[model samples]
Target chain A: MKIISSPLELKEYLKGENNSIGFQGSKSIGFVPTMGALHQGHISLIKKAKEQNELVVVSIFLNPTQFLKGEDLDKYPKKDEADKKICKLSGVDVLFFPHVEDIYGTDEVTLSAPNVRGYVLEGNSRPSHFNGVLTVVMKLLNIVTPTRAYFGKKDAQQLNLISLMVKQLFMNTQIVPVDTVRESDGLALSSRNVYLSSKERVEALKVSSSLRAASSMVGKNILDSKEIVKEMRKSLGDLEIFYVEVLNLDFEQLLHVEIGNTIILVEVRVGTTRLLDNIWL
Target chain B: MKIISSPLELKEYLKGENNSIGFQGSKSIGFVPTMGALHQGHISLIKKAKEQNELVVVSIFLNPTQFLKGEDLDKYPKKDEADKKICKLSGVDVLFFPHVEDIYGTDEVTLSAPNVRGYVLEGNSRPSHFNGVLTVVMKLLNIVTPTRAYFGKKDAQQLNLISLMVKQLFMNTQIVPVDTVRESDGLALSSRNVYLSSKERVEALKVSSSLRAASSMVGKNILDSKEIVKEMRKSLGDLEIFYVEVLNLDFEQLLHVEIGNTIILVEVRVGTTRLLDNIWL
Candidate 1:
């Protein structure tokens, strides 16, 4: 696998392989963006891209802008050597390990999340986070010029907003959302999962388990959104619950549950680390 | 030349082109966006693009979002068929004539202009105008994915904002500012010129001539910006002067004129129709 560091180098490298990646047969490109501490979750996304395209480009950018001042940006996991090994093992054609300057410049233009949609759920707690996520994603997409970009559903709202941006901006790239990869212990995989203390990691299971409990309630036909949220909150009793919303796939509040259209989401703090999990019914 | 009337159709066509037009070599895409009723100014932009790129695309969209509620959106000049004939004559490969629905959607994600830079001069008069202009230009640039986009310097503030958008947003396209195309009598060609009576059109010469006088002042080494504005205002004696200011290329106020680094801009009302003119020193 070829590892490219700078945007100019990546653009030059991708331009030569442009003809064999995506839909236009010879001139399409497939992109997969990750936050670097690659685990099975990122590997799963890479595997999907490898199956679908002739060339698969993966980006490992620990974006500083996405993390608020007091957030875990400084402590965010960085397994660069291990991450490179995984990319090579997973058949990633090129690994883009960009420096901070490679992605952001001084006096840069930025993206703003929609007022209503961007400030709900995850956005509610981490306000400017999505804007930073989107701005970097847009920069990466433009630089890569991918025909299909892979995003894991683990960051469900991030995936949704990126999809919305591509559609709204008329960006000529397809956003293929891969299913969230989870650990055998039912924990939805996250790069931030490393932040959990040993006991907190066990406690973090409640986030995913509560989501599973909500799914079971829907299976039993007790689909009242209020009742489901109430029950899930009860199940996640000791953990600090941020929200337990049973929203439609579009993140709109649902008065009545629609079987294939609903997402029961949970956000809770295990120790000091916040964890998120959801089930799309 | 193929004319695509709807944004959906244009998107479908773009999807087929994939990364070929933009990521591949030789054929560069040059774009010129206008609010129809194409005059020599718009024609000059198209002509310049034709010289620079292998494929030129011109979009005729009288974007409604740019006009305030009390402004003349209903009276915005639009001659679709004639615009098509002009594109055909100018060697435009594609004439994208998208309707409002093609560019904007219900409850859309949009681009906001810079708070400080956007809300000065024209933005001060039409408070939300630059917001609309930036939002639509973002949409158009994404849709066209042009190598270079053209704008006339007559709308100098608008040109500045668009260039800022491209740079700040990390957009790859270049913004080419063509000099203002003028008529034999020196009136800067504008579609809005249709609103002017013959006598008002003659009087509008004061807008450009004022800038000419300002240029003469600067040429003679009169360094004070205040003196330049005062003389330019005097040249437009009876016309309603909106603003006449000397500023550097970055739009920062200049205390003293510096050749090749200054732009003297003027705006005036000639019998109720507004006209803008500027000279880059």
Candidate 2:
């Protein structure tokens, strides 16, 4: 596996890979972009891409723009040498490790969100967060030039926005959304999950538990959104409930359950670390 | 030359192009995205791309989102067959002709500008215009993964935004900014120029002339921005003056001309069509 640090260098290397070999007599590229601190969740995305494409490239960068001023950006995990080792183990063909200056410049053109969609749940707490995420994603998509790209559904809203961007912009790559990988304790995996204290770790399960509880209630035909939130808040007692939204897949509020189209999302403060999770029905 | 009318068809064709023996190592894709009515200016852009890349693709799409509600969208030029002929004559390899439905869907994700940079100049008049431009450009860039994309400097602000999007988004293709093509009479060529009456045509030259006059003053070391605009408005009398700004290349208004870095732009109404021109010093 090659560790490519600069965007330009990775692009040049990818270009060579694209030109040198043929994909079943034609050449095609696959890409997976991550924020470093790799786990089984990221490897899952890469493994699938490797199975399908002539070439596979993964990017590992801890984007500062995505984290709000008080968020875990400063304390976020960094395991560069270990990450390279993991990439090699996971069969990643190319690794893109770009610096801050390589990804952004002064007086840049930025991406903003729809006023309605961008200011709910996670976006509400960190107002400018999605803008940063979308901007960086757009940049990465352009740099990789993948025939298909992989994204985990752990960040459901982000996956939705990326799909929306690809559709709206007529981006040619296929966005393959993989299911969220979770721990044995039913905790959804995240790099930020490390910030949780042992006590906070126990409290954080309230997020996934509430989502599961909501799923059971919908199965029992109790579909009212307000009723669902009421039950969720009770289960999440003592934890600061940011929001427990039952939104349609589009993130629009739904008064009743719409199976396969609803997402029950939860966010709460477990110590100083904010944890987010959702169940897409 | 092949005329691809739907996104599905184009995607399928591109996929085939991606995986076929004859496709690999055969060509570089050059792209020209336009709003249908192929004038000399657009032809110049297409011609330039043709010269640079082995396979040229031209898209004639009068993107609806880019036009404000009260703008001339209904009356926007549509020379479809003529545009096809123009591309054919210019040696374009493919003509991507997608309808509105082919490109946009409901509840689409949008690309927004930086709050400060996006709300000035043409964006001020058509508040949602740049977002629309950026969104469509993102789509088009994805749809036609050209080795290089061609744009005109006549829409200087649009070119600036596209360049910014390409850079900020880490898109792999290079942005080839073709110089603003002009009429022999010194009027900058524009598809909208057709909307102008003969009288308005003569008046429209004021935009270019004012930029020319401002450039000469900046050449002679007259650095005051206010004085430059004041002189420009005088030369462009009887037109509804929208704004006359002397700013840097980044679109920030300069208090004084910065020798090699200033751009004096003028926006004024020649009849109903708003014309813009600038001198990049």
Candidate 3:
């Protein structure tokens, strides 16, 4: 795998790749952007990209703007050497490792999240978070111009909003949502999982367990969103709950769950670490 | 020239054009986005695009968001047939004529202008104006993906803000600024010019004449921005002057003029019609 640190160099390399293949036979590029601490979740996204496209480009940059003022930005995990090895093993053609300075500028043109949709649930807790996510994603999309981009469904709101942005802005990339990769015990894999202590790790299982409970209730013919949420809250008893939302695919709140189009999302604090998980029904 | 009302068709056409030429030899698409009351000013921008690019695309979208309540959105000029003919005569390769429904959607992603820079000049008077301009321009740029997009220096503040957006976003297209087109008597061309009565038209000359007076003062070694603006205001004289200010290219208020990087801008109302003009030094 070729590791490119410069955005311009990566852009030129992609341009050359496109030119060499010619128009009729141009190779499709699949991109997976991550804030670098690779786990099975990221690898799953990369492997899916590898399957779909002739060339796979993965970007690893710890974006500062996405983190709120007192958030885990400073202590966020960084495994650059390990990430490189994982990309190589996963058949990533290019590992784009850009610095924050390369990705952002002073008083830059920014993307704002939808007033109604963007300020709920995760956005409600961390208000300006999705704005940063949308802005950086836009910058990366422009730089990569990928044929398709893969995102984990664990970040359901992010995925939904990104898809909306692509449609609204007429961006050409296809946003593919990969299912959440979890532990054998059901804890969703997250970079922030590294921050959890052994006790906190045990507590984190409740998040996915609650999602599983919701899934089970749906399977047994309980479709009312309020009932499912009530059961989920019971399963997540005494945990620091941020929000337990049952939303449609468009992120709109649903009174009753619609199978195949509903997402049961949860955000809970495992000690001081925040972990998010979702189950799409 | 092919007239495409649907954005999807225009996108497909551009994609086919790219594919036919291949990447290395891909034709450069110069874009000119307008509100569609074509005159010599719009033609000048198109001609400049034609000179710089292999293909030129012109979009006629009277963006409703850019107009404030009680503004001329309902009565905004529309000459679709004449605009189409003008585009063909100007050798435009494609003319994108999209309806508001085709261009916007509910709860869509939006672009915001810089807090300090955006809320002055045009934005100050019509507070949310530049946000609308930036949002629509971003949409148009994404839809067109032009090699170079042309704008007239007649809307200097708009031009500056757009350029800032392109640079800050790291957008691929080049923003080419064309000089303002004017009549023999020195009234800068605008679509709003139609709103001016014959007498109002004569009164509007003060905008350009005031700019010329500022230029003469600068030529005579008067570099103080305040002094130049004072002279400009005197020339403009009580014709419902909106704003008379001298600022650097970045739109920051300049204490003194710096030749080659200054703009003296003016906005005045002739009867009920508001007109804007500027001089880039």
Q: Indicate the worst ten consecutive residues by lDDT in candidate 1 chain B.
A: B17-26
The stretch of ten residues in a row with the least summed lDDT in candidate 3 chain B is: B18-27
| Best candidate (score: DockQ) | 3
Q: Candidate 2 at B235: error in angstroms? A: 3.1
Per-residue CA lDDT of candidate 1, range B1-281, in tens? 98998776775665555545554443578999988899888888999999998778899888998999988899887688888899899888888988788787665566777767888788888888988898889889988888999999989999998998776666779999999888887788888899999888789888888888887887788989998888888889889877888889988899999888988888888887888888899
Local distance difference test values of all predictions, in order: 0.85, 0.84, 0.91
TM-score (chain B) for candidate 2 is: 0.94
- Per-residue CA lDDT of candidate 3, range B1-281, in tens? 88898999999999898878754556899999999989999999999999999999999999998999999999989999999999999999999999999999999889988888888888889988888999999889989999999999988888988999887776788999999999999999899899999988888988899999999999999999889988888998878988988888888899898888888889999999999999888
Query: So what's the TM-score on candidate 3?
Result: 0.96
Q: Please give me the total number of clashing residue pairs in predicted model 1.
A: 7
lDDT of 2 by residue, A137-186 (tens): 87888788788999998788788888877777777678998988999888
Please provide TM-scores, in order, for all candidate models, with all chains considered together.
0.91, 0.87, 0.96
Q: Write the per-residue lDDT of candidate 1 for residues A156-270, one digit (tens) a residue.
A: 8888889888898888789998988888999999888888888888888888888888888888998899989888988898889888887887889987679999878888888
lDDT agreement of model 1 with the native: 0.85
Residue range A7-53, candidate 3, lDDT tens digits: 88888999889878754646799999999999999999999999999
Quote the positional error of residue A15 for candidate 2 in Å: 1.2
